[model samples]
Target: MTLLIETRELAVAAADSIVQPTSIRVRAGVPFTILGETGSGKTLLAQAIAGTLPDGLVARGEILIAGRPVQDLAVHERRALWGREIAILPQEPWLALDPTARSIDQVAEVYEVVRRRPADGARDDAVEAMRSLRLEGAGRKLPSELSGGMAQRVALAASRAGGARIMLADEPTKGLDAALRDGAIDLLREAMGSEGGLLTITHDISVPRRLGGEVAIMLAGRIIEQGPVEDVLQRPRHDYTRRLVAADPANWIRRIVPERFGDPVIEARGLAKFRGGRLLFSGLSLTIARGEIVGVVGPSGSGKSSLGDLVLGLIRPDAGSVRRDPRIAPLRFQKLYQDPPAAFAPQLTIRRALADLVARHRLDATRISDLMRRLRLSDGLLDRPPGAISGGELQRFALLRVLLLKPAFLFADEPTSRLDLITQQEMIELIVESAREEGCAVLLVSHDRDLIDKTADRVLALEGSWMDRDAVA
Candidate 1:
């Protein structure tokens, strides 16, 4: 086997504080995978290799691409290696996409500009890629118009557009359905092709299990366990690795559903909405009672978010109406966004942002400390900007702020899609517990049916023209 990318004693740090020293090597055809919880430095490792680390972070040690030493390379030299030698699929890739650019155009631009393909040929290749990913219908839609899953596919197309030999993929299945996830994985495997290499960082255990080659478990910015996938995952050695594997939701049998109920918090009747040039839903009626956990499960772009927005009155229904409790204020209704970074101010630290919210709402400042302790967040994280923390960490902060408002209803849209299995379980547990205590009506949307199965009291399934409701006992 030939080596494509190698890092020796590679370490990342902020100012003088170093996280951990890591070394990884990718062979010509085998995929190297890293599995870790959020904020465990998995993404930082990939970003270090790609030379795309966030602001205030620095990398040290040796980096080699295609047997060429590049750690000390100039900015332009390192940048020049992109597209031709190395390509990266960023976490939350949708955020990297141009909001105004059409999906196809974004992918095609990589071919035309980076690969130097002709305009006609670039577009044709992009079209083929999109078609293969089942995104043929989203070519003309803007990134904003596309669902998170569609945006993810589009990003994959763009990354592969340049035909890079060594690819670094971060959370490639962040927001994808199982079918789409398989397709994306297949594409990644194809990209490795005998002569190419792949380095993947993901929280999804199944990704490494299926890809199969080598796996490393990262914890607190260090690789605690590294070996063959089966050996590391099935017969784990480290205690943390053992807990991580055992924490998977797949192992859960069933969740306890409470019998206590409250008055209706909101009601929707004959609701209809047209989106993405199609009828999302028609004559849809549902009511959520206070203290109820309503789970919404659907494929991407199947109108899960749209339905939440409609019920929240963020958007007017085409043919029906949503009615809320006459005594409750509109501010009592909150939403936990799928993309955490987009929810906060880039210029402010977490502490400042939370304080501002408290002042604006006249909320008790003590609530922040109480909630932070419950969420297992450190006071140190509050001093950092939103972009400085991990997505999962930021999401917990989002939930903390929303809870401070004492919301009557919360629409959590794929709140755990980007989180590790442990974090996902913890957040859902907090949400359910809070609903019980606060009498908050929760309309939770997720691509993971298992999560919906465990956390939701009543499950609402939506995919295309299909709609079904079932009570979990």
Candidate 2:
């Protein structure tokens, strides 16, 4: 196989050294993977390679594409190269796409802009991309119309259709179910293998293993381990790599999620939701008691987000009624989303945002401040705009704001999907503490099995149109 890209002693520094000088090579007809915990510079390294690193990020290293140095290329020049030779599937599907355009139009634009094609073949390719991803009824649908999984699939199709020789995918299976995740990995492996080269960046250990490729584990901005998938996963030499594998989200079921709080915190009977032409779920009966976390696990397109939306009243159920303590059900749930940056106004400081909420609700200010600190944030951070904070920090702030409402029921939808291992731990601990303090019932929706096993007392698996609820033993 020919070497497609090479990075020699690549070093990137931002707020300190995010990616210590590292070197790796990508050969055609293979999936070269970068694995690491969140905030460990995996994403940064991908950004550096793609030439889309955030401003103020200082990078030092040699990135060679086809034996040519690419660091000196202009932004537009890089774009031209990226569109035809490299493609990136960002971690956040919604953020990666435009909210206003139809899904088909967005995809068509990708082809037009990247392929520089005004030909009828572009539309044919776009539709084929959607079909390949199994995105039915998605061509004309807006990003908002599709479920989380559907939108993510559409994004993948767009990237694949770009026909780039190299692909960089970040957390590509984060919100997908086991089946869908496997399928996506297979699709990526086939595409890369058939045409030649692709590099995937993810915290998910399972991905590289299934794809059977060279794996490199990054930690504190360095490539700590690199080898074949079996060698690294089964006989990991690095301590950090071992830790990352041990904490794989798929293993969450081995640990026990304690039911320390007593009593039913939230109750619902025969809950059903119907919208457009789909039935999310019907006759869904369940109860969540205080000190108990129930995880709703399912594949994409199986209504995981829809279930959360029903409980939160973000979308009203057509048939079933939802009853929750008035004090706990906030119109806008804060803890469930990782990028609170996306929800906030760029001009509003964090302090003003929280203060405005407190003022509107006639709540005490001191309590809100204390909550923020407990979440590992500083009093000074409150003065900065949400955009100024990292994704993890924004998530913490968002969770704290929800806690400020002191809701009796917490509905978390894929709360850890975008978080690194450490942040995932912190957030889980915070959730347990808040549940214990308020005797609240927490409903968590996630694709990470390890997260479910460690944080939930019960598990519900949704497949196709069925939900099987099981008690955690």
Model 1, 89-150: lDDT tens digits are 88876578998888888888999999898999988888888777778578878888878888
lDDT of 2 at 50: 87
Tens-place lDDT digits, model 2, residues 347-410: 9999899889898988777787677666667676788787555555677777877887776677
Scored by lDDT, the top model is 1
Each candidate structure's count of clashing pairs: 0, 7
TM-score of 2: 0.86
Q: Which candidate is the best by TM-score?
A: 1
Total clashes, candidate 1? 0
